[model samples]
Target chain A: MHIQVIPVEGLPIIHPGDLLTEMICERVTFEDGDILCLASSVYSKANGYIRKQDEIVASAEAVRIAQKTHEDPRFVQAILDETTDVILEDPFILSETVTGHVGVRAGVDHSNIEDGMIILLPPDPMGAAAGLQNEIARITGKEVRVIITDTCGRSFRRGQTGVAIGWSGMTAIRDFRGDHDLFGHVLEITEEAVVDEVAGFANFIMGESNNGVPAVVFRNCTRWTGHDNLHFNREEDIIRKALCKK
Target chain B: MHIQVIPVEGLPIIHPGDLLTEMICERVTFEDGDILCLASSVYSKANGYIRKQDEIVASAEAVRIAQKTHEDPRFVQAILDETTDVILEDPFILSETVTGHVGVRAGVDHSNIEDGMIILLPPDPMGAAAGLQNEIARITGKEVRVIITDTCGRSFRRGQTGVAIGWSGMTAIRDFRGDHDLFGHVLEITEEAVVDEVAGFANFIMGESNNGVPAVVFRNCTRWTGHDNLHFNREEDIIRKALCKK
Candidate 1:
């Protein structure tokens, strides 16, 4: 099926207690069954989750946590700027308020933003997926799926590929073990990452340079559902994740 | 640069002492600097690199090597079928005579061939590169670089991307660290694999489903030369060679 990605822009700077769903839905076009994938850093930026350079005075509690990894104060501050909520302190994964993307540190984007401002990944990406799905359903009277994607490093290849950190309405893993190869061997070691593959394909359309298309409509994907959260799996859980850890 | 890839087909099965460079040059058009990437297995098949399945004598040395890796007898036979010369048995890299490609097990392919046939990787990829480069240069009177490419499993990713196992007249690595980024941070970590990137792009055109395109011509990449193997810094070397163990 031909998929079209549209990047929605022009949202006002968001503040605490803002109606985020309403604000985003107003700007974005919605159709029932459409899957909207948003970048987490953009969400963080609109929400004014900015931390000034001076506000980063590390307290005793912060110092105690940083000591476990032997990290410096600035490193701790960098993490703080990109994080809305700390999930597991040991592994140091964080949640962002903007894009509903969850991972190890929000995509705090030091590349494109001002020195004082850092972007965080979305907080509770799974929750964000559910909310987007529901909001689209309520507004358009058709069920839709939402996937919050973040560009992250892979252990093996040189560049980053898009991953579905938060997903609704899709089975992430496509098992093909019993399938036959062209040589008639029962195919093993070939579970296709359905969500990540689609995300990567969409990422190509969502050009790295100001294409402004943030969301793509994946139509005719009959194997997915919008109400399920059980299918989104972490890359680390798979054997292939070992390649990018370098 | 505009690149064209075409597969070689319809030639009679090759045998030992067959003259490939001249024979192939006669069948196809060559411009100065056109790179020919052939799968070693196809070359081996044409060159009579095969052993009958009924030839059931297993050597003790073969069994010993197979036992060390916990591999089956059939796999061991497959490995033996394509190997023509043993280069440095301690490191375990082999060289095949059929296609002039060298690597582990000599690119003996079982993927797209009939039973009772084994295809070896090209015999001497680097030598093949130089020979083909010279042939193309002689015929077209234009300097050409040749690259002998093969599909090798990457350490991290699930599928294979073509790598330049051998090349002539090309800068394999291009470092752009001193350049400015969009945000003007000293651009580091952009030393691209020019060979691998070109190979990957070639693969998109030379698909597995009988496209009949094996070699591609890349023009306007004059920065690449037929001389000088890429000199790797310690950090880049660590990443490049880390994927394939000795």
Candidate 2:
């Protein structure tokens, strides 16, 4: 399938009641059966969701959080360096973020943007994904799956790959229990991490450090189901853990 | 630095004394400094490394290897299904043969070509890698790196990625201890898995099946030293035990 991950740019500071569809209408569009993977970082960027730099000032709370994670407080300042921004809480999650992804900085990022502003993941990312899916379906009159993605750290390997924090209209896992290998052995240990695989492939097109391609449409995957599957923590998480074998 | 992995095709059967440069020279050409990551399967196929199907029918040795790896006698039959044309072993490895790596069977694919022929991995993959690198350097007089790749399983993740079984002219580990994070706290968990990272990126272009692009060049990487210093192991076996923070 021809899948493309396009980043959205040029929006104003988004507010609580801002019209996201209107703001993103021009540069972004989708087709039926297309899969779009969007990074929530851009959304936070447009809305000026940042933690100010100077204000953090190595506060006792910041120092404590850093110590808790075995990180330096000055590292917190570097995270805050992208903007004069504060997250009101520590974004470096030990496991999953509020969005339930084990991503770097809890999916909160301060890189490659104006200083004094930081970006937190979209609140209720699952809802945000469903909303975007519905919005695109309504606008284009086509069924499209939306997966809101953020970077995540793998347990065994270093570095990060974009992960599906929130997704809509997709069967994120493919169970392969009764399947046989070419040799007739029952195919075990072969359940593909469909979501993570898709996410990793999408990341190449997503670009690193601000190429601005956030959403991409994937075609030719007939195996994907067209239903609301926003709960990534259950099924998807199981498949992820199984694939990781830990 | 930009790195890409390409598949190579049109390989001929190989014998012990055969020259690989001759076999691949027509189909796969490389420039100076281009790293070659050849799957062992292709190397085996070209060398005419074949095990006759019927020969193992009455052999107890065949049954022993097969039983060790939990394979059915039919596995011998399946191997015959792919190639009576060339090499065979009673059973390949004791391990599960990692779901996605290249070996006599995993990537010794026939789909890319016609049926009734099997490809085996290169003999002495590490040695071949070193030789290939030396050959490329001799012809072009430019330093090059060679990574003889095969698929292997990870302890934590289910799927496999191509890893350097044999590598030359590269320091696969980029240790980052004593390096300070922004916070100045010691960066303990920061030693990067340089080989796996490079292999992961390389697989994107190498792909699962046909796309006939062999070798990828990674340019402008300041850290990629063309020195042979890599050791391969299972991810689970390698991870240090987690310290209990009392």
Candidate 3:
């Protein structure tokens, strides 16, 4: 099946408590089985998760780590506050967020925010994704999947690719455990992370630059439906298990 | 600039010594600046990298690890032979391939091959990609980037996504270090793995099922050209540095 990614452009700068569904609805129309991938930055900004540097109080640990990493103490404190546990401390603070995503600075972003402010990941990405999906369904009278994505660096790979932080209305993992390949070999351990792949595809169009398009709609995704679960919990994720071994 | 991914269908089952460029060219025409993403399986198969189970002799270490992970000793031995270092033993064999890609089973894939046979990753993926790019350019007289991709499980993330194992004719990393974001914040650490993203996008259309479409042509990729480097060497990669802290 062929898939098409259409960028939803012309979105005004999102603000705290702003209805992202409303902004997106004004820009584009949705179709049944369409997967709308939204950048996590917009979700964080629209949810008022942006924190000013002046408002943060550096902790003793934050100060100690800040000096080592050559980072602003207040900014480091914001990252520490958002982290559940520090995974790495040398070159940068690789920490696990409360939501269980392991990344540098607890997935807290410093770029794309106003001067002296940093954008924290959406407090509840799954909830945000679910709400947005439902709202879009209500407006268009069509079922669509919503995936909230963020750009993150991966271990053993250079550069960054978009990852699904939150998703709704579609199965995040496409399990191919018992399936047979063209040569009739029983495929084992072949679960495809369809959501993350979709997020990466969307990020290619959204781009890292000033490509105002923050949201992309993927149409004709044959594997869009069929699963019961919409959200991927990091506590039970494979990536977390693999990382824990390290 | 909009991007369109068109699958090149009707290729015969590829075998060793098959001319992939001719096979692809016979089915579709090429345009300048098009990015051609080829699945690594086809390359490996065409290059006769497949190994029969009987051909492998399990070593003492392979037998020991196989007992723990419950995998076939012979298959495990093949993986061990292909690996430069074992990264993890528990759950499964996560190892670094000789090419420096850190993944399970040293990226030795068992699926899509005949029973009792497995496929190894393409040797010298960069050279293979460059050769393919040059062959296509020679035939069509049009400049096109070539990316050889493999679907592999990632650390700390569920499911599998397409990754660029080799590429030619494009800058693999889109460095945005000194660039400014929409809010005028100097963007740091925003290098996008453009090749990997393109591979992931192509894989979405390729799917894991019996979609015979192995190659995809990406058109209108405005960011497709202007850069020289195409290959990603893991020795000098950022992910290696981040993981070295452990």
Candidate 4:
């Protein structure tokens, strides 16, 4: 079966108080078991998750980091305000959010929005995903899965790829703990991050520039059962430990 | 346009001399400009990139690292042989291959093939992708893009997602440097690793276990132009520097 990846087009620029779910439902017909991926920036904007840059007072810590990053102190303050743990301050502000998703600037954005304003990642991404799923089901009467996506930089790779910050109606992972390979050998690489996989493709459809696509719908996806432990705790992540040591 | 993701299913277990391009062509009708993602393990298996475990002579360094990682010394030796530089050796042998792709265990596989043997990543992945693209075009008379994929783990995120090790007929990145967002501001997140994004969704369709799927065809994918510098250099990567310091 061929899965269809449909971009939700023709929507106006998202802003505060916009009815994002209704607008998406107007664009494409949703199907049961369909997976919908939304850019976190759009979702945040629609939900009034933006801050006026002038209102944010920079702390001494933020000012220090801003000197190293060469970013505005207020912009650095916005990142520090969203960050739970500051992992790396220089080069870029690599930090963890409240939801345990580690990203540059804690997933804060200074692009795509009005001037003098900044966009934030959905403060409660999992809750945002669940709320959207329920809202879509209520409006369309079709069960649909949702994933909130954020573009992130990888460790060894140079460029950024989309990652799932929050997901609903599916597990974050497709665990293959007892699964075997073609030769009947136990699979060494279990626990596929399927949500992130789907989100990466969704981000491809929703280009970073001014294409105006912020949401995508995927049809005919096969379902799998797994747990939702997508983020590694401080004790488990060896790379995080290494960075902390430095 | 909706992108169609088709999985190449139902082929016999690959032997050393199997004609992989022919097998895929038999299953999938050729279309112009379709992006084909092939798992690196399947490509390696068909091209005889396997080593006999018993024949491998473990170096003293391999033996010492084996005790730390709790793996057979031969497997450690296999990883070391393929590694250009060892990034980490204790938790697992995270190393960079000759093609500049850094991966855990240097992309060696001990599953799906015959017991007592291991599969190696295609020595020249860029060449492998180009050869496959050329072969497919010759046999089917239809132009197609190719990407060699490998499942890899991330630093902050748990579990593995597919990454593009090598690609043909498209840029490794979709450079949006000069593109403007909705607000007409200079784009900060410009370079999108599009090949990796496409490869990631392909991995979702190709499960890790005994589903027997190793290839995926992506139709209607929009192309972009960018440079092919996917992997980061030693001094450029802050994470690598931190790990080396440790």
Go through the candidates in order and give the clash count of each.
Answer: 39, 62, 2, 0
Question: Which of the CAPRI classes, incorrect, acceptable, medium or high, describes model 4?
Answer: high
Ten residues in sequence with the least summed lDDT for candidate 2 chain A: A82-91
CAPRI class of candidate 1: incorrect
Which pairs clash (backbone N, Cα, C closer than 3 Å) in model 4?
none
lDDT of 2 by residue, B1-246 (tens): 222334455554344456665555455556556556665544554456544333435246435646754655545444434332222242242121322122344333332223334344444556677787777766656676776655443332334445555566666544545554332444333334445444543543443343343443443333432233333223331121120110
Question: lDDT scores for all predictions?
Answer: 0.50, 0.48, 0.79, 0.94
B239: Cα error in model 2, Å: 4.9
lDDT per residue for candidate 1 within B133-158, as digits (tens), equals 77666765767666666654332223
Q: State which docking tier applies to candidate 2.
A: incorrect
Q: Give the number of the best model, judged by lDDT.
A: 4
* Model 2 CA lDDT for position A227: 32
- The fraction of reference interface contacts (C-alpha pairs within 8 A across chains A and B) present in each candidate is 0.03, 0.03, 0.52, 0.91
What is the TM-score of candidate 1? 0.51
* CAPRI quality band, candidate 3: acceptable
Q: Pick the winner on DockQ between candidates 1 and 3.
A: 3
DockQ of every predicted complex: 0.09, 0.09, 0.49, 0.92
Kindly list the per-residue Cα lDDT of model 4 for residues A71-151, writing each as its tens digit.
Answer: 999999999999999999999999999999999999999899999999999989999999999999999999999999999
TM values, all candidates: 0.51, 0.52, 0.89, 0.99
Give the i-RMS of model 3 in Å: 3.8
> lDDT (0-100) at residue B26 of candidate 3?
84
